[model samples]
Target: MRTLLLSLTLAGLLLSGCSPLPAPAVQPTQAQPAPPSPTQPPATPPQPTALAATPAAVPSPDEATPVAAPTSQGGSLPGGAIETLDPQAIIAATLRPDAPAWLIPADPELADMTRYRLDVTLAPDLSTLTGHEQIRYTNRETVALDVIYLHLFPNLWDGGLQTTDVRVNGQPITPTLPSGDDILGLPLAFPLPPGDSVELGLSFSIAIPAGEGVGNYGEFAYQEGVLALAHFYPTVAVYDAQGWRIETPSPQGDVIYADASLYEVTFTAPMNLTVVASGATLDHAAAGEGEAIWQLVGGPMRDFNIAASADYQKVSLQVGDVTVNHYYMTKDAAQGQAVLNWTIAALGLYQRDHGPYPYQELDVVETATSAGGIEYPGMVVVASWLYRDPNQRDFFQSATAHEVAHQWWYNVVGNDQLNAPWLDEALAQYSTYLYYLDAYGQTGGQGFLNAMDARWARVGHAAKPIGLPVGEYVNREYGAIVYGRGPLFLVALREQIGADKMTEFLRQYYHDDAWGIATPAEFQTLAEAVSGQDLDALFQEWVYP
Candidate 1:
């Protein structure tokens, strides 16, 4: 158990900006951040050699009694540790109880989840990509399915994406043209019954737009030597309570959601280019003529992302069984190390409070994103600008901690972000407060909250509900509500519920929702249960109203 490398000097510096550090006064709804002033790209440094060839040994389990897994409407969830359960008793005890049925199956079979195996090639100049994929999708819903939907999210960019030769189980199938939406509807020859799986095959190509990213969002285009690909692939759409999430891309906030599944993705690019993606790279081989192939395996993860560059220098630090890696250029080595150090500390704090991080490796890479950073499952992409100025080190540390918290909130505990932005963003923001409080002392944490209050009073006081969708808030109100006031609501909740009980409530919530989606209603039910207090008025004033 290594502690965060926090020194009094660094703590003093981090305490400077009490408000959400570095976010614009009027923040954009989308995560894309305004580009920093252009600076010459730094030369890549040599990659760090492996320090130990063997995997780090796992720590002995703690001596405390293992808490029994919480019971749900069902007797016991699949993969959950055995525990006594009385569904009716649990339901009757809650203040704001949800329906008896679980949103997703209580015992979802991982073998029946959607899985993808992709082999893709990137252009030498990083301008284009050609890909072929084999998809295995299951109909986990109760109803028979007539159509399969694939979201070509990258089409939201200029020049967009092109697809050809689509097939289902090796038989040729015609895909309906892009339906003015980002969806590609593939009608099955016959209805696929529930609990059945379908194999889909497709080939497509994408042209990477070049230039500064749009609307605080860094462009998908090639810049310096890096090519960032977020929604670059045709992702499967989630079928949930609202039906397939086929909403067109909006410049503000994320619009994608899918069930966690397995991925075996192989990316081919110029031999000199280094590919960093959601999962660990399993193999790398040269393809001759200055090209190579990198094979990756990731998931049970919500989504997969790839960021490749020829100039990335890599470093790693070991914490328990997990290895934290930082990628940056020579000029940004200090900043990259700063992110790594903060990530290690945040990871420790979150695992202790929430749950253990299941992944073996966590990556933090320096790239150009519209926002200060974006969280993937096991990896995070941080804005290159944060590494430029030494004076901005505190902001850099804050942003890194915030995104690392997302590994628990958004990545593992999936939520319908499009519908309830606060469920993840607000929780992640509040977790940052916990990190600072635990890392620094009470004075430092209180100061951070004071800054947030100042910002909220100035701009976010008019926000309708803390749980509104991304579209409901305009301009800085998104940050003010989702990031600022939303967390304040949690702080207020902690005030009502004793601190010890608050921690117990969150741990129970995280444990119950691990590897599953959680709604505000579900959270409310659990909160009341853990605190032994009816929270109707509190939730109404801060959460719903």
Candidate 2:
């Protein structure tokens, strides 16, 4: 989520020396995990393919365990291998038969990735949601695991999430919420060895808060007949060299840090409302009287998001095999069309420079958000206020371009957004610059660069390191530095390396890390490799802490 302060008026706010109050920081007391052994090398980059043509062979029944389907009451299944699940069955269940070729995972390396199947229903008033999720998680780490952690992100707001009926492998289990209400720890019956997999079933109910006082960009709130549900479910946490990342998040930056996974969602909503969500809509039909059900599939992507409104009007255009849909209020039809145009332009430029977008559908929805824009896997939420204010046209364009660029940096090529946000956010900002250069030519590109200069000026051109964690910066520093000076660092690097090398570096980095998590070390290594110039001094002066 790009904060609201990225607007052109931020320079005036900095001149006035007034900033939003900082949220109190909650420091973690948990000991950090030891570093990886020296003998282990960094992960090799994956080939630039989306899905494998033929599925991997399923495990033999002798090697497989029986898994039970989740019951509505959250009861445990009978203790036998009554039903068995394999990778092919899970993939078939999650992916739509009519899904485009690109959405299928061609790379055999992604066979063990996590898969989620969700069945949820939204209240007629849009005040709450109740659902059950079945998660198929593989122990991708080298070391064995005794527990699994899940993040309940909506607990950070006034409303909260209640989880119940937790089961692992058809047996009931009690999970612990140790520190913050956001993290849930499930103790396994036994250690899950490396290369092993586990099935987790749980039921959750969420109280949707009103948008006014909801913080963290209000991405999870419901307001004025519009619902923006981001991270509305209990999502599994990523385990890295630092151990389970259950730290309480700072309100200043994006909340989720997760790997690419497959999602099959069955959502039931009021018939009057129109839904815009991540992924392709495989099925939409009447569920019952006055209600409708939508079956959607998205995958090998980071996260799933949804936006719904009874008053929404949509405009769509086909770009190649992908469809671009823009949803807006009835009164803002012209502005909605403009947004659609800009989105298509940016998407074309990004596809030319970066790789093709992996999904078959892209949605840009106008919802009530505190930030300029918030990006999910295949969808983005643009602030509704931007469409009403004519004076904010430039900010509107900048925000749209920035969020579309995230399709390449954040969704297709994954990163640890909580720690190394610059890997995506800074790159997205630079990609927005490329959009202006491609769409509007030199004059418009120079105008956008001047805005970047003004943004960095808000911090008085501070030489602060850009690689620090999100919590390390307080108040306006997070935006002023990460969103401001962070992009300038890329511009400087582009000058040091020739423009041609910089372009190749961006393309290579996208292909190499497609559908995988990236790190600061790997980023620098790739940049140096592409340029064939030692970037130690450049990173030391600009990026390193």
Whole-model lDDT per candidate: 0.66, 0.71
List, residue by residue over 377-493, the lDDT tens digit for candidate 2.
878878776677544555667688888888888787888888887888888888887876675556556556666667677678788888988888765667777777777789899
TM-score of 1: 0.81
Name the top TM-score candidate. 2
- Give the CA lDDT, 0 to 100, for residue 279 in model 1: 60
- Judge candidate 1 at residue 271 and give its lDDT: 71
Model 1 spans with C-alpha error above 4 angstroms: 1-108
Tens digit of per-residue lDDT, candidate 1, span 370-461: 46777777878777766764444545666788888888788778888777878888888788888878766665476457646654765837
